[model samples]
Target: MGQVGTKDRFELVGTPPDHQEAEFADAVREGLSASPRHVPARFLYDARGSELFEQICTLPEYYPTRAEREILEDRADEIAAAIDREPTLVEFGSGSAEKTRHVIEALIARHGHLRYAPIDISRAALEASADGLLADHPELEMVGVWGEYARGLLTLERVTDSPLLVLWLGSSIGNLTHTEALAFLRDVRERLAPQDRLLIGVDLVKDPAVLEAAYDDAQGVTAAFTLNLIARIARELGGDLRPEDFCYRSRWNPDEERIESHLEVVRAHTAHIPGAKLEVAFEVGDRIHTEYAHKYTPKSFAALAADAGFAVERNWTDGEARFRSCLLAPR
Candidate 1:
């Protein structure tokens, strides 16, 4: 087996607890039991949770997946041609990596041999995706990193001599604050060689109604998905949480150019957390802010890439222009 790099040890950064599972459960109880209800979506992806998300993407209500696929299908050849050399493909938050298969296949067809490094939060998901990729493309070498997205990116090393084409797909970039996004991109830039390229997907600014529907899907799947975080905490940490007490709500914060997910407390309450050894109280109508999905315009997006030391090479958009995939080159 090849040696793993010093910085590539993902366990140290995204420490998911086996021993502290009970404590985490208590944290969940305290969080939900608080006046304003909130739980982070990052915790929603356990083995089963990740499988649920993959199903969510396939649902008709999800536009990001379909739109991204259309753009990739329409432009994979163009994207393939743009790369001057066959490079290792590095993906951040590589979930099922369904769309990535197209790009990876395209690169291998043109380049003959390519290395793949898929960084993800779930070790199970990483191994599953890597195993599938290896079975399909025996020529492609894969190095899987199980780590938090932002932390892992900061710690990634250039292990392969092949030039890199890094991917931050699924508009997962939107999950961060604007400042965090900028700094994260800048970190990516600092890690690359001058000629390396990046292909980023950004959900464009759109109707508030559309944005709201996507997050708060009519089928109630999104709501269930949000509530699962609380359940996960309860199960893992030994906290008593009534999932019905909190409602999943999403609203467009236009001024901030983001969609905010909040878990709202329906009534005043108090709860005891056995694991954390704390008592928490909640006031009626208090809400815990969960996540923010920021939309971006092409101009602002280009400026962000530029600041990150990348020049926008080409832009591809869905027919309705609801989303865009921009190819960028390191400056």
Candidate 2:
């Protein structure tokens, strides 16, 4: 029901928080110096790199996309009605904003007005999504909060009205360490007006095979996606990383209940990070751990939100029940 009209020029308005770039650089430096297999999950999304990831979602083994899409296709209206009224749609780490359209469309069907805001570290992504969404739904006024999710929360004061619905979709929240996730949601709860709500997508715990396949698809797209982080560093600060020197590995960490991605060194070598003036050594087969995707259960996710001052109000699942979309309200 979102108004479709002539496309308007979309503006990309923001960049990473100044300190973020510095911190990211430092993390990379420290990570490189510490071990052969250390890489940050965040560096995986440069312009071209991000496009590769969208391709990753369509690979047959990637279940989150298909699972979440099924839930939206079947239950978007039910999901929309769970929220009480018209609200600004604010999405954290909004990415290309594809999944968001489902709920946004449903919201507009029930309520004639909407303001769409997406927060992402990549200005290119935000602008691209805003332009597409604006063109498709002229009734939805799009805004981009161009910063890391936590810092972007600082800009929430710019939105007004009650029952604001903030979205944290695509199982991206799984990237955070448990402690970090709790602290972040707590900060978000503190910033909310009383009637505000949060809708988050979670990848559910499943068979080890299914979990492993999602990250380490047979097509190797996910592997290529992981290695691109190295290419990103090479281009960013003039670092020279031989992409072939590192290989991607994804494995289930049963003890931690997560899937971990690592970059393993194929040979002993040294790489130069020009900006940091650092020569980092790598041992053959040593792994620089990059990311962990923690799968969640209904109880665990609800508990995590509750600990952060939220009450789970509704839950939506796909036909396969492989993923979950949770709607929570401020306590």
Candidate 3:
């Protein structure tokens, strides 16, 4: 594999070819200028934001992570068995890859050796996790990609020769709107070979109160995470933002079957982002849309997979049925 940053055992592969700064600036400007001012959830993950999100995963109300992990632990053997012999595992948005160890161990037991490709936008997260994963799985070969999902998949086309099993776990796909999710899944299907497979995790529709509580946790960690976007703008884009002037709130939008998180301006304020060359004015009660987590039913998600040219081969769910992990193959 092509290596970028090689440590004792871990190897970083694939260069980041995108101009992230320019892209971020453009996205920020566009979102701010839109009729209903908003920000993309992807921008919420700088180093500190990523750390906060990791903490959020462990919060009592955040059941997605725990539910997904339970399914992986219970059905990892079945998941590994569905893949081809000596398959290469590629994971998208693999933050720390904590839940992936179950699958890795199961694959290793069946094949004796394995190849893993973990892609993430955060170089720090990739580098930090690579060493520990390498130490734990001595019979594994790892390649780390520091980029977003689509770019990393393009790079994987060149690096992996074995049958591919692409993973998009933790219900992170819920962040995308239905249309965007279909488009993205189609892109992924196009990138995969005929024999390639995909294992995706998705959160299921549940009680509105439960959904809302997950995003607005008791410890205020979720609030801190939502407000970190303002801090990031101030630090990276030279924006004048007072984070304390805003409050984070989350509500269940039953009409859309999604949870929406917003940063509500507590008072009138103007924030200027020098990097984007834009200024945004907010009045009291004004809210900027920050994130959306869409919940799906099993039939709805299966239809989505079919639309993307994949046939759902097998699906495993947690005991509570609050989450599901579906294995799919090209139709």
Candidate 4:
């Protein structure tokens, strides 16, 4: 654990991810040993994967990023106005903080002064974005947390006196399973006061074709993003994975009600990682489950939030209703 320091307008707290490589090795061993090979999506966001995702966001079929921005562009001020008390903006998975500028501007405009606390896994990305943001917004001060979301959030009360506006945007919650999401939100609820608010982005249920295309694009960028996970295993962890043997796949699992991302074995292959002590075998039909993006209707999301002890204060959507930005107050 590292102590929070305040020497600059935008300061980074928490320790660097010295344990990530060890965790990745452990995860690879665990995931590959399972019956259906699986890998956690978080591991896919290494430096290269993060860059590819930024490109994925710009794709025509990928609507979450564009949809979220539309809502913020139209209603950010209204969202900001709901919090009468001056509040600090805190974001989880606050990558480049590209789409976040909308809400940041609104908060600064309404409050005259604003503080942003961005929590992320990458210290370099956080610092780079922090510098860029500070340069753009002179009134904005920042406190960055370069580790997990929970650690970043717990430090807020000690760092700033203002009420906290926690932003879990970009449909991040949708990445978790129902049980996981509930438990995660409950943990977050435990850390917040009744007056503190959380704003979340929820992707709405849409046409199956639309969902599938968003993940498996015509240009094959999404495919590269999926392959990068296996590529990462080989590149970083001394795994002998023939990335060419695995092909990217996306499907709408109607029974499960989610879009599934996978790497299907195009040809039978085996991978061995000395670092993780794993030797995984694959057949032509074998699949490596990489990610799941669940879509929610408003009713479904609100019910889940209520169970986690939050009340929906506001819900904003794009023109096509492709996504939702929900404001939640502690119940």
Candidate 5:
């Protein structure tokens, strides 16, 4: 955390005292010990995984990024006007904060200056992005929170009295199941004042073929992204696993209204992680569920907002309706 001159400022917010390595080991052990083993999608975001995801966004099949960016580009001014005067902009999972530039510029134009708070689990990404943003926008002041959504929100001390605008863009909410999403939204609602606004990006239900292709791109960047989780466990937790032992698979689950990503064991294998003191045996065809991307229709999302104590104020979408950015206020 440092300040440059009078214009640029940055602060790194620390997480709770829990050691990250111990937490990762515990999560891995608990996840693998369960029947129908699964890992939380959040673990898929190590440094390498983050880089691969940036590549995934540029792929032609991945429509969410482009569609969401389109809406932000077209409607940032309107979004800023809705929030009105100087407001502290808070973004969740603000990786690289590339799409954030539009909204930041719009806010700066409407008001005289901008105060931005970006919450992210990766300290490296947060610091790097914050530096670049600070260098670029002299009118901006930023505090980078190094924690997950709920924890970050709890740690976020109010920086400005000008109303709060929380941005959860890139459809990352799709990572949570319906019930989990509701609970998470409720937690967020509890943290906000009644007048505070939330603008969230959500991927829309579309052709199953399109969804499937997006997850399993021809270039195999998404595949590498999924496998990187295993590599991460091995690198960080003393797990003995080779990338060749498993294959990547993505499927459109119409019944679930989501796309599922899995790492299927191609051959019988045993993974031994000395760090966690755990051994896991996998037979051929045994799959580790890695991620889920849930797609929502407008009606479904509106109902979801209501259940979480938020009233949908407005929703902007791309021409193809592949994605949506909805504005909501606590009911």
Candidate 6:
């Protein structure tokens, strides 16, 4: 990556350094202390965890990434044309911004110039993506926002003066529960300037076997990605949580219409966290619930947008209808 953007264009916002660490320690302590133990999925994306996830995206069992990419590649021109104004494309959780190049190119091709705002919690990933994108797109102007999605959205309000097209790709919205998603979208709706639109990718409900395999792949890449959290605990929290004592597993929770990931205890052990100043004991059969990916049908998702104070402007799906990207406008 070369020809970095100007200093004023790239700045780290949101949680401060000490506070971020404190929040991580606090979250780990509290989640472990709960009866049904769990860890937040955001913590799973440390540098190595991020790299492993890139590997997971390529796995054949993981259909969402491929399916979503196909949707964008096929309809990006149409998607870009749907915008009523020349809008800056803002992407939430824009890791690597790999698939996003389709949308970026489409916007520039239509409007002749483009501005991109990428928001990410991982500053390193955000910076790297920015460098690669800048080197390639001379017509592109980028203002990188480094932080959580909420703070990043707020940052966009301050940095941008043009209409906005927010990109929430990769079916990442599935990370939130139904209630949380509604609240999350409402928060975004409250922040929108006029002419702003949101394009969000979502995984569609399908066969339980397919959903389960996507999360728990045959090559064990997905397993390694999930277990990287335990590795993170040892590395970052200075915790004596032996990674070998746990194994990764996922299930299709039909009742929830989601895939639930867990790190099942392989052997009974006690873990001591000096950083968090906490200790926990686990039984062999006990599970530490880690994450889930909720699936939705196009109809249900459109209704979801409506409840969240937005109208689904248009919905684009892949040929198999395995995934969809919904363009929305604030009601």
Candidate achieving the largest TM-score: 5
| Regions of model 2 farther than 4 Å from truth | 1-12, 16-21, 35-37
Task: Please identify model 6 stretches exceeding 4 Å from their true place.
Answer: 1-14
Runs in model 4 deviating more than 4 A are: 1-7, 155-157
* Residue range 1-331, candidate 5, lDDT tens digits: 3335533388788675357677788888988888778889988987899889999999999999999999999999999988765789999999999999999999998997988999988888888788778887888888888878888888898755778999999999899999999999999999898779999999999899999999999999999999998898899888687778999998999998999888999989889988778999999999888889999999999999999999999989999989999999999
TM-score of 6: 0.95
Better of 3 and 6 by lDDT: 3
Tens digits of lDDT, candidate 4, 290-318: 99999998999999999999999998889
Which has the better lDDT: candidate 1, or candidate 5?
5
Q: Which stretches of candidate 3 lie over 4 Å from their true place?
A: 1-9, 14-18
| Ten contiguous residues minimizing lDDT sum, candidate 1 | 1-10
Give the Å error, residue 237, model 4. Answer: 0.7
State the lDDT of candidate 1 residue by residue for 1-331, as single tens digits: 2233312322223435563364355556556666455555566777767877787787777899999988988888788777688887888888888889888888888988767778877777876776666667766777776766656665667665768888888888898887888898888888778778888999999988888888888788877777776566556555565667778888999898999997777867775556656566766676777778889999988988888788998999999999999988888
- The CA lDDT of each predicted structure is 0.76, 0.81, 0.87, 0.87, 0.89, 0.86
Order the candidates by TM-score, highest first — what do you get? 5, 6, 3, 4, 2, 1
lDDT of 3 by residue, 1-331 (tens): 2233335456676654357777778888998889788999988987888899999999999999999999999899999999768799889999989999999999999999988899988788887778777776778778888878888877765554679888999898899999999999999998888888999999999988888889899999999998998888887789788799899988898898899888999989888999999999889999889998999999999999999999999999999989999898988
> Candidate 6, residues 1-331: lDDT per residue as tens digits?
3454544344445556677678779989999999789888888887888889889999999998899999999999999998867888889989889999999999999988888888887777877887777777778878777777888877666454678899999988999889889999999999886588999999999999988888988899989988988888888889689889999988888899988899999999899998788999999989988888999988789889999889988889899989999999988
lDDT of 2 by residue, 1-331 (tens): 1224533433344554566567667878887777344756777776777888899989999989989888877888887787687877889888888888898899888898678778887777887787677777757777688777877777656545557788888898899889988998899899887788888899999999999999998888988888888787777767778789989988998888899999889978888888656788778888888888999988889889989999998888988889998888899
Give candidate 3's error at residue 91 in angstroms: 0.4
Over the full model, what C-alpha lDDT does candidate 3 score relative to the true structure? 0.87
Which residue pairs in candidate 2 collide?
37-287, 37-288, 37-289, 38-288
| Positional deviation of residue 15's Cα in model 4 after best superposition, in angstroms | 4.0
Error of 5 at 285 (Å): 0.5
Using Cα atoms with residue i matched to residue i, what is each candidate's TM-score against the true structure? 0.87, 0.93, 0.95, 0.95, 0.97, 0.95
